[model samples]
Target: MSKHQKIVIIGGGTAGIMTAASLSKQKLKIDILLIEPSENHYYQPAWTLVGAGTYDFEKTVRPMENVIPDGVNWLKDSVVGFEPENNCIVTKFSGKVDYDFLVVAPGLVYDFSLVPGLGEAIDKGVVCSNYTDPIHTWKVIQEFKGGTALFTQPTTPIKCGGAPQKIMYLAENHFRNKRISDKSKIVFATPGGVIFGVKPIAETLMKVNERKDINLRFGHQLVKIDAKNQIAWYALAPNMTEVNPKELEISTNEGLVGIHYDMLHTAPPSVAPKFIQDSPLANQEKWLDVNLHTLQHTRYQNIFGLGDAAGIPTAKTGAAIRKQVPVVVNNISEMITSNTIGDKVYNGYSSCPLVTDYGKMVLAEFDYQNNFTPDPKLKQMLIFDSSKEHWRLWMLKKYGLPYLYWNKMLKGIDV
Candidate 1:
């Protein structure tokens, strides 16, 4: 190892910022540089609440400089490509920025182009998505007169998989409050067969769906949208080829399932940023090719990837990154000192606060292999099982988590 080493992190979002904050806390005599173009940082997990009109959208953003740790060199530039073989990265304006170690945390990008009409349809008329604009989503919800409200997600991995239904649940509650539930129907379409990956959470979500009278259109993969006609079209998901032949949702003539909706909430297809797909670091799926447990680049020993762009099989939520940040930081420290990984390994632990109603939520905490691992704090606080809906979990989603994120997590305090 050299007498002085520099760590360069790509992206100013949660993963990069958290990694930088964590590294800075280590007080290592290492030069740290963060390459990011955005001047504003967003606490995106709160965007779900924003769309539901429970959270202030203005509060989710902060100046990039505010969240960045002190002493870390901030290179306000975008990454265009990488020269990993040479331990340098190509930036849009700065050209090549060399580093002794690199952390790829640029996160993923929404590819609305993947769906034929989504690019033109999103954030317009009744087609609104929190991923695009939470304010627009709130407006759409307010203007909805109540008919068929369709919510759907693509088969591709997306940040916070529970977001689609979270908004749906909120909207249903709103409709019921307005006495429109009798005249309105909530339809949730998803490619996955189960409501959630973990068995216990899945069961609970199933019961919530039933209780809310939501029509679950499983095995449906949204393919296109006709905004003019207000019809969302879906094809059978690749993994769901064996769907029941008697499924009435199928349009026999077109071989597609068409749902006429008054309102549409879409969780657009998310993919690794184009630069990552073009770079050598991406896997066949165009995601960061990192070890699932170690989070180190499969081919580059000095590189680590986390956050939404990582190809970890777990749900990409803030809680997942919360668990992953320490592993990356500790492993990097270990490598710098002993030239090897330490005992720290991320077990794919991720938690999603599933808001089932206006004031109730279910906390879905699980690890790799879809094993349910509820938070011990729930038991400590006498909150009992997290698989079932509780008001305290809702409070966490609305208040506690955000407080922890800004004051503790981003400050490098392990909460």
Candidate 2:
């Protein structure tokens, strides 16, 4: 068994499943093992609508048996540890399997406990994050029928930068349509100074917030939550810093502050997985050490990674998986055959279709660099395109994208 040609993928989600399909479709007669802990695979992008009441929760999840490529062995367990040095991994099930190559794309885990009181608040119903399991987001939204419905963005990099605000916008829209708009006060508290990373889209979001009358708080970090009292505490950003040769002072910094809330939507900080973080393949920030261009492990050419697990400095989105899959596939193919590989850089490309209202969206796309410039001119770009409202985007998200994801992206078929 150990003598066969094999490629072991560490996850069965977007990257893992797609990579397997890509390889198998090429008629590569090799042993492939997919290690995933859960039987249910989630299309996480649609969770925003589920929180908003636009989409049903059941629609976002699919059985793993349906998504894993045929001819690949699916191990329904997690990689408890990785022995990358020996070209193998130890899974909770299926024991230790050696491989000719490894593709790590285990996604990410949300550490709610990192923030004091956050876990308690989430459990108690005062605070809920759409970025996590999302089972309780609806409850949190309903509980906030009035008074201080707060949404927050943390200091760490999140999966979808727009997700926190998207949930907020959806909730606001729901309130408006449900005749409860006057009761709830929507407040967006973000650690970032801007509403969005992309500037043009940020301008539009600012206008939307103004029109919706949602309060925007910038550079505020959520440090704690009081579930019993429905109060949240945060450290506000400093106004300015003064530095001298001998010392530096943050004079305008304010005291840690507390605010009352009827409901809260939180986005927790994220980091690389523990296994990758502990391995020598991690970079300075402890993310998977991969070449920015090839998506191949910097030190180990036979190793590659994508999705949130990869240390590439890009907006972590499923759309990112679409781009990275090609790079990893091509690079790994070249490495196996000992050929001069062509360089294919990801350009940090990721997209967050902002659902500003029930039927309006500003598609934001950009590279790893902060330069979030969209295609110079799309066929349609304006606020007045009412026919193509947020609902169309919602349809794309709910109905269209999933098919494209399962049949096209995961199967490695270019559509």
Candidate 3:
């Protein structure tokens, strides 16, 4: 390694750009290089509102050139392969670039094809996922007149677990607005037993479910979809045992384990990209293997990771990235100064603003330990306060959050 460090950041999404901004502000004597294939950088959380017809898709994205910090070098190319042994990454257009330190933030890949007939259903207007770009979500909702409108969550972890429910709430509200609430049937099918991960929110969601007349299909896994027949099938596991209230052992056999749906809003199985999957930096489970506390590579010391790519067992949301970026930036700085990743530790802090409806959200915050915590004392707390259904949070999601993301979070402005 040279006297001055050379840092390479792949994927200029939320994590990549924010880390760059944060590191640049520290004024480290280092050369920062960022590689990204996409010309457009998206505030992905905003896509949920876009799918609900509350915001425009065009407004959800900004040019990548604008978001990249002023001092860093931006490589407009995809990383085809990683040569972690050489401390370098091979780009598609540009050849190999070596680095003293590497930061991989390539977001998780959504596998829509994992569930049979999902591709066909998406095309045939029977399926829609907010996670995808060029989203036709509102069209899918508009096509639904009656019958069962199913929302599904896969066994695999997703970026925003709450997002599946967010869309469901919107669809339920849509049916109510159209005076079709009684006529339309809404159901939630999940591999998990509960609606929300946090208990307080889950308890509240149960009440919301009853009021909305939504059926809860627990221990149900989506296996196939028949777009032609407008039928979606899920594997049934009745009398399944689960730890309820986050700890108490309980079993429920009454809920429908296997249920069919007329129109399905599916959240596809997601994972780290194939390039990272093939690299040594990947965990035994095939995720980018990084220290849960430091966000530094477990096996490779020079390589660090954050965002959805990291193997940290937490909810992979932008809220999580907001917490992880600082830990990663600080630790990387320590590594540069001491020729090793110092003792800076991440508390495994991650957050998810569980948007129950257009106006209601339960801000679920917790550390990596999975211990239940409704609140944590961070400099900038993303609060999902007691106001489950309020115009204020809706306005925040609609107007304030994006402004904060672009101007503050992405720009490295303190919250």
**Which candidate achieves the best lDDT against the true structure?**
1
| Model 2: per-residue Cα lDDT at residue 287 | 87
lDDT of 3 by residue, 356-390 (tens): 67676655667776555654332133444532454
**For all candidates, what are the clash counts?**
0, 4, 1
Against the unseen true structure, what C-alpha lDDT does each candidate score? Answer: 0.88, 0.75, 0.77
Query: Clashes in model 3: which pairs?
Result: 360-388
- Clashing residue pairs in candidate 1 (N, C-alpha, C atoms within 3 angstroms): none
Candidate 3 stretches greater than 4 Å from native: 133-135, 238-258, 372-388
* Tens digit per residue, CA lDDT, model 1, 197-285: 88988889888888888888788888888898888888876565332122223342378878888899989899999899999999988
Ranking by TM-score: 1, 3, 2
Segments of candidate 2 deviating more than 4 angstroms: 1-4, 133-135, 239-254, 372-394
Error of 2 at 140 (Å): 2.8
Per-residue lDDT over 1-415 for candidate 2, one digit per residue giving the tens place of the 0 to 100 score: 3244688888888889888888887644468888888888888888877777667788788899988888989877777777778888877667888888889898877666667778666635667887774768877776666777878867777898889998888788778877888766787777777787777677778788877888777777877776777777778778422111111111222477676777888887788778778877789988888888788888887888899988887888998888888888777676665544546767788888778776556677777776664544333433233222345555556676777876798787754
Looking at model 2, residue 101 earns an lDDT score of 84
Error of 3 at 319 (Å): 0.8
- Assess every candidate by TM-score: 0.96, 0.89, 0.90
Best of the two (1, 2) by lDDT = 1
